[model samples]
Structure formats: structure tokens, C-alpha cells
Target: MTTSNQKPFSYIAPGAPKVVKAGGVANLDLPILNLATNESSFGASPLVEQAIKERASQPNRYPDPASTDLRNAIGETFGLDPDLITCGNGSEEVIDGIARVYARPGDEILFSEYGFLQFPILCWRTGATPVKAAGDGLKTDVDNLLAAVTEKTKLVLVANPDNPTGTYIPAAEMKRLRDNLPSHVVLVVDSAYCEYVDDPAFTDGLELVAGHDNVIVTRTFSKAWGLAGLRVGWGYGPAEMISALNLMRGIGNVNAMAQAGAVAALKDPAHVDMVRAKTDEARNKFEADLKQFGVVAVPGAANFVLVKFPTEDTNRRAIDAHRHLAAENIYVRSNEDYGLDDYLRITVGTIEECDRVIESLQRFFAA
Candidate 1:
């Protein structure tokens, strides 16, 4: 075993999932229809386009170090105080900030078995121990996670509507977990895909942050707002937690154009509505198709489907399917490193994109 402080980072595992690497579509020298990244195929709002274009000329000016205006917009949208909000270049940055602020050497961070892959990576960067609680059929099992907590556990991350799998813990269950967790552990709910979710029973996380000092809910423009390129995400929590994350991040984290784009994206409710409707339709079609293939598709509130492979050659099948789809200008994700080597995560795309992927799978299975 390598030491944690070994050069070139012995802590972060080399050969992490291939799917996490960039260019599922871009690298495949084919026609390139990418459904791999869980990106909004509907693209950004026109308002954001106009705002970016308007701000393009002012590249020389330094962005707001405080992110004052963007913070205000986020607070207003979520009905939180500005002091309770913290913005960063991306939510990943916020994750790092949390580790820096709360974790010290030898401290442990707890997460579900299949939570966002990045949270553990952040813990490692801070020289903290990353621990996992067993997940309940890909859904975050709050009971198991709560049991995993100890005095050494300083952070607990729950990715509601968890990525790749898309399963969500209901609001009631989350409340029970939060109410039961140790006070010393800070709870982070990464709501990256929250905007696409339709269930009223789902916890928004921000509402809990309203009164709870230990709970922090983070959101992003990357998922639903189609601002993945710009990378603007924020967290809402008690004033003290937000301030601590801010102090850890220091100044000039978010740039000027990203702030402008996010502010504009907030104003365009119609775009969000349109994408949600389309995504729901696509999800229904894809789920039905997966059933015919004898694949067990997990029910999720998010915008992607996690389908388990039937054969022992799960990794090969997924890679072949991905490669074949790229030949036909379509792309999807194969989960080898999330510890589910037998499952492939397919993002919901346009009706045409969905059909292309389904067709490619049909051909792959036929052979």
C-alpha cells in the first residue's frame, strides 16, 4: 500500500472510471450525438446568450470578488438570506471548500456507497479519511449512513437524486437522518440535478438549511440551466457555515461572465419549464425501451437511468455499446468505477437521440 502523501497523489486512485473523463462524444471520431454527460440537450436560455454577449467586451475588468449580486439572486430564488449563500466557480469547488473548512488530518468524511464520486476525492485532498456507508439498492440508506457516523466523522454527504443511479431519498427520510445525525458532522446535500426532479415528496434541502446550522444544500446552474460550460454553483446554509466555506475559498472564485449568465438564467423560467417537460417525456420512453431489453431500470427522480446488464461480460458489453453508438453519432455512460461494473448509465436526451441510442443497443444485442 502506498502512503497518503506519496508524490503524484497516492491518495486519489489512478485509473478511476473511464466514463468520468471528458469527451464521451467529442473524442469518438463519429458524427457525435452525446447523451453521456447528463447535460441539457435543450441548451441555455436566450437571455443567458444575450447576457454573455453583452459581457464579452468587459473581459479586462476583474469579476466581483464577493459575488454580491449573484449571491443576492440565488438567495431570492431560494428564499434564503444573502448571508446564507456562497457561490463558487462550480459546486465541486464548494465541496473542496467544505473539506478545507471542516476537516483536519485524520478526520473522516462519510458518504453513501454510490454518492457523487467527487466528494471522497475532496476529502483526500484535505488529508481526511473518506468512509462509505452501505447503500440500499443504489438509494442512499439514511439509517446505514447514520450508523456509520462517529466522533471522527466531520462531514456527511448525501447526493439527493444521486448521480448515475438517479434514486432519491424522500423528504421525510432526510429529515429523520438530519435530526438523528451527530451535531459535529456537517451534512451536505448536493442537489446538482434537483431542477429536473418532479416529485413533490422529494426534499429540496434548502428548506432544511433554513433552520439547521449543520445542514448545507448546494445547487448548480450546470445541470438544468444548461450552463455546464460556465460552471456556476452555489450553496445555501446557516450564516456561519456559508461564511466558513467562503473564507476557505477566499476571493475571486466566480468570474464576471459566469455571474452574469447565472443571473440571466434565473430570470428565464420558461426555458427551465420547457427542458423539464421534454426530459420527462424522454425519460418515460427510455424506461419503457429498457424493459423490453430485459434490463432492470431503477426508478429515479433525476434525468438519467441506471440499467443493470444481464450478462457477466457487463463491462465489455457497455464499452462495445458505447463505441457502437458513437459510430452512429450517439453516446452514453458505462459505470465501471462507481463499483457497479454491471450497469450502464444512460442520460435522457431528445426523442431522436433516445431512438438512436435504443437502435444502437438493439443492434449490439442482436449480435
Candidate 2:
């Protein structure tokens, strides 16, 4: 007999199918009204489709290792220098790259209580320790995050308008945390949901990146651009930080089709604006509609709402509600893994999609 000491680190991935696959019925529902993944209610822009089609015949060739054209387009669109942008397969890769470059074994990577589940996985991937600060009512708490930092904390990650919970930290508060943090720690602002933000005071952290060597802002084409399948994301930061990320990035991390599609997606601002306007309208209406059932949803600026259910014990109501929706093939996000058993995160879909849930939910809550 041989004994081995090899074990893999733990990472719970998002975007798992919400179909109840245990019993045959769980997976048998048809035409799932998916409000689970925070995918854009609208699909990709026409330009992106055309751009991808233009490059479809060249699959046999290797893509540009550095994503030069894509970076140039992003730089011009956002007024950032290409030198400051590092494109990745998705913002997830950019984030993981940051962990590999900055954090070593036994080093500490810090984030908010409900920041992103991926943060822990990234830390584990780099053999770094994960430190979490308490949140303030589902929102990232700046003071708590600042208080949790220690000398060994090499990287600090904050997801503005964070996932699952969908609560955001305003620009002033975000700045306060940055100002208070020691200069040695690198702060990563994952602004995956920034385009949906209507708050004038909210920032995607570009100003912070403008001067701070220790600050980097990560963005994605997934949510607002409706390019989740394309897996295109970029980071804007100091030249040195971008350089380090590029060094750690895999060859052709952003695929050819992804690069072409993202560039095209950027050229059409009207499509994104329409998505933003429509999402805002749907979200506001969804929130108001839930109130009729005495339910309160977290006012999230993203394209999703974290709806809370009245529970007597063991989060029974929320779990039951999830199953009830599941039976009807209407899938929304269950936050049990995020320690939010009493809440379900629902993506704001089209008016028709949103309407489907209301009647079903009324039956659950009223009964």
C-alpha cells in the first residue's frame, strides 16, 4: 500500500445549472426561465456577431499572444493607454493572474465577507491565505475591510456592486478604504457590473488607477455587453502592474473570436446603453412588484436583485420557494453557498420573463 499527500484546493464555481437534477423531475422541466446566471437580459450586439463571423474561418491559427488589437481598442474607447490594459480570458483570469503575480504561499489575500466566491479559489490556487472582513447588511464594509488587513496581506480585492448580494460601496467610501490602506497592499476593484450603475457617486475605480501604483480595476464583456460566452475581460492599472499580469498570463489567454467580438462590442455604445436602461427599468419594477407580497429586495445597481423571503426556521421558506420555482422551470440563484440561505438572487430579465415569476411567487407567498 502506498500513501500520498496530494490534495487539490477548494473552489466553488458560479454559474452552475439551477435545474434540480436529483430526481428525474428536477431535471425534466423544459424551456427553463433562467434568472440564475447574471447574464444580460439582451444577447450580444449585431456587431459582435459579425466580427466573430469574420474571424471564424481562421480557427487553425494561433491568436495574438498579447491581444494587441483588443487592448488598443479598449484603450481608445476608455481613454486609457494600451500599456495599462491587460486582457484576459475573462475578468476571472485577470483576477487569478493578480493572485499568481502578487501572492505567494502563506501570503494573505483579503476581500469582503461576500465579495466573490472566486477570491477564495484564487487564493487557494496561489497557496495564499484568504481573509474576509464582515459586511454591513449585505454590503461591503470599508471599515471592516480596513480593520482586517495585516502585514502579510499582499492583495485586497473588492467587487464594486458585488455579486450575489448586489450591494455596492459608493465612490467616496471606496476612496476612504483606499486612502486608509497601507501603500504596500495592492487593491483590485472588480467592476464587472459597473455599466449598470446609475449612481452618479459610484465609480469603476478608474480615477484610483490613474495615479495609484497599488490599484488595479478589472472589467469584463460578460454582463452588460452580453459576451459571457466569449470570455473577454481586461484590467486597467499602473504600467508595472499590467506588465506583471501580462507576464503571468497564459499565451493567447483571450481567444481570437473573443478579441474580435469584444472590440466590436465596444464600438456600439447604444446597445450597452439600451441594456442599461432596460435592466434598470426591469429591476425597479421587480423590486416594486415583490413589495406587494411583503418581500424586500436588495436595491442592487447590477442587473439582478437579491430577494429575501420570510423564513420561520432553517431558511425553509426560501428553500421551498427555490424548489417551487424550480418545479415550474423558473431558475433563480440560491445563495445558500454564499451563507445567504434566506435569499435568492434573481436576474432582471425582459418584461415577459419578469412577469412569469410574479404570479408563481404570489402563489407561494399567499399560500
The best candidate in terms of lDDT? 2
Root-mean-square deviation of every model: 6.8, 6.8
Candidate 2 residues 1-367, lDDT tens each? 0111221111124544344533545645345576777877688789998999999989998889989999999989888899899999999999989999999998999999888889999987999999999999789999999999999999999999899888899999989988988998999999999999988999998888777899999999999999988999999999999999989998889999999999999899898999998888888888889888766898778988898887654433777787777766777778878899888888888876788889878876665
Model 2 bad stretches (over 4 Å): 1-29, 313-316
Question: In lDDT terms, how accurate is model 1?
Answer: 0.79
Clashing residue pairs in all predictions, respectively, total: 1, 0
Clashing pairs in 2: none
Q: Write the per-residue lDDT of candidate 1 for residues 1-367, one digit (tens) a residue.
A: 0011111221124642332222354333335565667777778898998998888899999889888989888878767788888998888788778878898889999999998888778777888999999999789999999999999999999988898789999889888888999889899889888887888888677778766789988888887788877989888888898878888885888988999999999898788898889888988988788776676788886667888767765543666565565455555676776888677787787777777777867876776
